[model samples]
Target chain A: MTTSPPLLPLQLSDVVFEAGGKRLIKDLNCRFEAGPPSVIIGPNGAGKSLFLKLCHGMLAPMQGQVTWNDPDAVSARLNQAMVFQRPVMLRRSVSANIHYPLKLRKVGKAERVRRTEEALALAGLGRLRDHPARVLSFGEQQKLAVARAWALKPQVLFLDEPTASLDPAATHAVEELIRAIHAQGAKIIMTTHDLSQAKRIADEILFLFRGRLLERAPAAQFFEQPQNDLAQAFVKGELLWWKLGKANRKRRD
Target chain B: MDDFGDAIRAALNLLVSLDADLMEIVGLSLYVSLVAIFFACLIGLPLGAAIALFKFPGRKLFAVILNALMGLPPVVVGLIVYLLLSRSGPFGVFGLLYTPTAMIIAQVILVTPIIAALTRQVIEDLWLEYRDQLLSLGANTTTALPTLLWDGRFSLITAVLAGFGRASAEVGAVMIVGGNIDHVTRVMTTAIALEVSKGDLALALGLGIILLSLSVSVNGAVYAIKDAAQRRHA
Candidate 1:
C-alpha cells in the first residue's frame, strides 16, 4: 500500500437524499477528522447505508454537499474505500478478488502481487487464495472484501453493516479486523444495529433515527449519558423498530 | 434393412479408409463455420457488452431487436447475402457470390445475433451485481466493460458454442451461397443433400453419420473443457 495524502476532515452539509418520493436522508450535517473509529448505531431504514454511500461518493445527494478537505475529488475518491454488508465477490479466485481494485487503480504488477500476498496473509486466507471466492463461507467472503479494501491503503474505510449476517465467531473476527484497520491509521466509519458490537469498538458514537442524527458523543459518554431522548431510549434498547414504526404510523394517519 | 446395413458398412469403410473427398468436405465445413464464429464473436462480444453497460436511448429496442434476430431463418439470411453479393447488387463488384467467403458471411450474419444477445444477457447480470463495486473502485462503464466480459468468460463460451452449433448445423445458408460446388465449397451438409438427391444412399448416410459425430465430438470436447475450467475458477 502506497503512502497517500490524508483525505480527512470529511464534511457533509445539509445532505438531503430522497427516493421514490420519500426522503431517506434528511438535511444531515457532520464532520469527521482523523481519529478513532466512529460507529453509527441506528435502526433499520434509518439511512445508515445511504449515508455511507454518500460519503464514499457511491451516491450523489439530491441536495447539500459531501466534501472532503482535499480539493481534488477524483484523488479523494481513490483514497477511500467502502465495504457492503453482502459482499459481492468477483467470479474468480480469492487472491484475484484482492488483486482487482489494485488492478483497477493501475498498480504496477510487482506491487500488486506483493500487496495481494500481504493481504492474503493478513486475512489468514493464504490457504484458500487459489479457491474461488464465491465458494467461500459468507464470513470469509466479508473478510476477503475487507482485505481487498485494505490493500488499497485508503485513508478512510466505510463499512455498512459488514457483519450483519455473520455468526458470533465471524462477528468477532470482523471486529478484530476493524480494530487492526484503525491501527493502520484509516478512519473507520461503520454502521451497526448490534449495540454490543458498537460498545466493543466505537471510540465515538452517533445515534441516527428517522434519517436524523439525534446525538453524537464519545463512545463512553454517549452510552452512559445520552444527550437526546431517542438516543437514551436507543442506548437502553427500549425503542424497538416496531415501536418506532407504530409511532410513525400514528403521525402519518 | 439391407440398404441400411450397406449404408452403415459403407460409412465405416469411408472412416477406416480416410476417404479424401469426405475429409475435404469435413475440412471445408469446419473452416467456414469456425471462421464465421470467429467474426461473430469479434462483433458480438463488444456490441453485447455495450448494450449491457451503457444506458443509451433505444437500448431496450436494440435488445429486443437482437433477441428477435437470434431466431432469424437461415434461409432468409442466405437470401439476403445472396442478393447482397449478386451481380446487380451493391457488393456484386467483389464477386463474393456463391463462394466460400459468401457462405462464411451468411453464417456470420446468422450467428452474430445469437452471440450478441447471449453476451448481453451475461454482461447485464454481471453489471447489476458489480455496478456499485466497480464504480467505487474507480471505473466507469468503459473500464468496467472488459472486466465484466472477462468475469463472464465461462458463460460467454456457451454463447460462442451456441453460435458454432447454429453455424455447423444449418445447411440452407451455406447451400445458397456456396452452391454445393464439388471440390470448391462442398461441405458436409450440402454433400449429404447432393448425394441423397443423386440416389447415392450409402455416401449420403455416411456423410450424415460423420456430420452427426462431428457435432457431438466438438460439443463434447467443449463441454468437458468448459466444465473443468468453470469448476476450477467458479
Candidate 2:
C-alpha cells in the first residue's frame, strides 16, 4: 500500500444536521486529532452513524463545517475511506472489488495487482481471490470490504458499525483488522453499539446521546469513572430513563 | 381453409427455394431496423444515463416527456418525418424523401423514446444502490455513470431489443416515409402491406412468417443474454 499524507484534526464546529423536519444532530462542536482508534458508543437512534457520515463529509451539516485540516472535502476524500454497517459488494470477484477504487484513482496496472494481492493476503482472503464478492459469507464479505478499503492506504478510515451483523468470531476478526489498520498509521474512527467491543478497542471514547455529544474522554477513564449521568447509566447497562426515574423518585421520597 | 392451406404451401415453397425477392425484403428489414436501433442507442443511452445520474431543473419533466413518447403512434412519427423531408419543408434540401434514409429516420423517431425511457428506468434503479458506494470510493456522478451503465448492461440489452422489436414490426411509419418503393425502400413490413393489398396472400404469409421468426429470435436472444448475465453474477 502506498503511503498517503496524513489528514487529521477533523474539526466540527457548531455542526447541525436536520432532515425531514427533525434535527438529527444539534450544535456539535468537537475536534478529533491524530490518535489511536476513536470508538463512538451510543444506543440505537443516537446518531452515531450520522455523526460518522458528517465527519467523513458524506453528509454536510446544515449550519457548520467539517474541516479536515488544509484540504477541502473533495480533495480530503481522496485520502479517506469509509466502510458502512452493511458492506456493499460489487457484482464481481473479490480481487476485482479490491482493485476498483485503485483503478478509479488511476493506479498503474502493476501497482494495482501488487496492492490487490497484498490486501487480499492481509485480510486472509487470498484463497477467495477469484470468488464473486456477492457470494461470500457475511463475515467474509465484511472482511473483503475492509481489505478493499485498506488497499487504498487511506489516512483516515471511518467505520460505521462494520460488524453490526457479524457473529462473534467475525466480529473478533473485523476488530483485529481494524487494529491492524490502526497500527499501520491510519487514524480509525469507528461507531458501534457493542459496549464490550468499544471497551476492547477504543483508545478514546466519544459518548453520544439523542444527537448530542454527552461526553468525550480517554477510554480507560471513561470506563472506570464516567463524568456524566448518561455515561454512568450506560456503563452500568441500565436504561437512562429508568435510572433517571429512580433517582427522581428517591429525591421526592 | 383452402386459402390457408395454399398460403402455408406458398410460404413453405418460398422458404425452401430461398426466393430472391423474399430475401431482399427480409434483408432490407434487418438493415433498416438495425441501423435505426444503432442510432437510437447512440443517442438514447447517454441521454438516459445523464437523466439518471444528474439533478437538473427539469429532469422530472424531461423523464415524463420521454415516457409519453414511448407510446407515440408510428403513423404520427411518419407524418412528422414526411413533412420535414418534403420539398417545401425545412429539411427538404437534404432530399431524403421517399428514400431508405427517411424510413430509418422515422423508425429512429419511433424507437429512440422506448430505448431512452427503459434505459433511464433500469439505470436509475441501479444508481440508487451504487450512488453512496461510488461516491464514497472517490467517484463523482460523471465517473459513476459509466460504471452504472456497464453493470446494468444485461437489462439495457433487453431495452434495446424492445426498441428493435417495435422498429421491425411497425409498418405505418415506414410505408409512409419510405413510399414502399420496390427494390429500393421495400422492406418486410411494407412488402407485407403491399402483397396483402395486391391479393398475394401467399407472399404476405411468407413475409409474416419471417417477421414472426425475427421477433421470436430477438426475444430468444434477450432471454439468453439475461440468463447468461444472471448466471455469471450468481
Candidate 3:
C-alpha cells in the first residue's frame, strides 16, 4: 500500500459565525494532521455541513481562518473539490457534465478524456458515461458527483452528506468510491449523520451539536465512547440523529 | 362584405403570384423586428442578470422602473421615441424621425424592459435556488451572478424569444416612428392597418395571416427548446 506524503491538510483557528442575529458556530478551533481521513458527525442544524463549507472557502468566516498546509508552508490551495449531498448536474449529458470543471480549468482534449475515463472507472460508471446525469438514479448521480470531483485530482475533498439520500446497496457503492478516492491520495473530510459510515470510512471523527463542535476523536473511539453528553445522546438515538444509527444497526446486525 | 371576400381572394392571388410590394413589406417588417430584438437581448440580458443578483441601495427603484416599463403602453413608447427623434426634440439634429431607424429605436425601447424584467424574474429564482451551493463552491459575488444566469439558460432563451415575438407583433410604436411609407417602412402590421383602412382587405388579410404564422413559428421554436431542456434536466 502506498502512503500519502505527510502534510497538514487543514487548520481552523478561532472561527465564529453569526447569521440572522444568531450565532451558528462560536469561537471554534481545530487542526487535522496531514494524512488521515476525517469525518464530521453531527445532528441536523449542528453546522457540520456549514463547517465543511467554511473549510472549502465557500463561506467567509466571521472571525477566523481555515488554512490548508504543507510541511513547507501553510497557505490556501485552489486544488480542493467538494461534493454536495444533492449533486448539482448541469442541464447536459453525463459526459458533458463531467467535462465541465475540466473544461473550466482548460484541461486539453486528450488529457480530459483520459482523466474522465479513469474517474468513471474508479466510480464503476464506465458504461453510463453517455447517460444523462440528471436521469440517473439518485445513487448513481451521487457516484457521478464523486467521479466528477475525483477527476479534479484535488488535494482535499469535502463531502457534505454525499450519501444522505441513498439506499443500502447504493450507499455502499458510494462509500467504496470515496475509499477509492482516498486511496488515490486525496485527504477526505466528509459530513454525515451516519455514525456507522463514519466508523467504516473515517480515521477521525468530529462531533458537533447546535452549531458547535462538542468533540473530535478517532472514529473507533467516537463510536465506542463519545466524550460529550450531546455526542452520547446523538450516538444512542435520543437526539434527532436523522435516522443515521437506525439504518446502520438494521443493516449491520 | 362581398367586396371584402373578393379582396381576400385577390390578396391570396397576389401572394401566390409573388407580389413584389407585399414581399417587400414582409421583408422590411422581419428585418426591423430582428434588429430590435437582437439589440434588446444585448442590453436586456446583462442588465437583467445584474439586477437579479446584486442588492444595491437603489435596486428596488431600478426594479420598479423596469417592472413599470414592462407595461408601458406601446403608443406611449412610440410617442417618446417620436419626440426624441423629431425635429423639435433633443436628438432631432440627426433627423432620423419617420425612418426605419426611428422605428427600430421605438421597438427596442418598447421591448427591452419587458425582456429585462422577465429575465430578471427567471434569474432571480435561479439565484435563490443555487446561491447556497454556489457560495459553498467558493464562488465570489460577481462570478455567482453570471454562473446562476448560465445555469438558467433555458428560461433565458425563452425570454429572448418572447422579446422577438413581442417586437414582431407590436405596431403602434413602429407605425408612428416609421410613418409606414409604402415599399419602404410599411411592415406587416402597419401595412395590414393601412390596407384595411383603405378598404384593401386582400392585402390586409394576407399580411395578418403571415404575421400569425411568424408568431407561431417563433413560439414553436421556443417550445421545442423548453421541451428539450426539460427532458435533459429531468
Output the number of the DockQ-best candidate: 1
Model 1 Cα lDDT, one tens digit per residue, A46-159: 889998999999889999999998878878999999999987888889999999889989999999999999988888899999999988999999999999999998899999
By lDDT, the better pick of 2 and 3 is: 2
Please list all clashing residue pairs in model 3, or write none if there are none.
Answer: A7-A34, B7-B202
**Each model's TM-score, in the order given?**
0.92, 0.92, 0.85
- lDDT minimum window of 10 residues, candidate 3 chain A: A69-78
lDDT of each: 0.90, 0.89, 0.81
What TM-score does chain A reach in every model? 0.93, 0.93, 0.88
Interface RMSD of each: 1.4, 1.3, 2.8
User: What DockQ was computed for model 3?
Assistant: 0.40
Q: Which parts of model 1 have CA positions greater than 4 angstroms off? A: A1-5, A239-253, B1-10, B86-95
In the range B1-234, model 3's lDDT, one tens digit per residue, is: 776676667667867988898788878888999999889988998899899888899998999999998877889899998899999999999999888889999989988998899889998888777776555344546876666666777788888887887889888998888999987788889988888899877667767877887788878977897888777777
Docking class of 1: medium
Q: What is the C-alpha RMSD of each candidate to the true structure, in Å?
A: 3.2, 2.8, 5.5
Q: Write the per-residue lDDT of candidate 1 for residues B1-234, one digit (tens) a residue.
A: 776787888889989999998888899999999999999999999999999999999999999999999999988998989998999989999999888999999999999999999999999998999899888777899999999998899899999999999999989999998899999989999998898899998878877888988989998999899899888766
CA error at residue A55 for candidate 3, angstroms? 1.9
Best by lDDT: 1
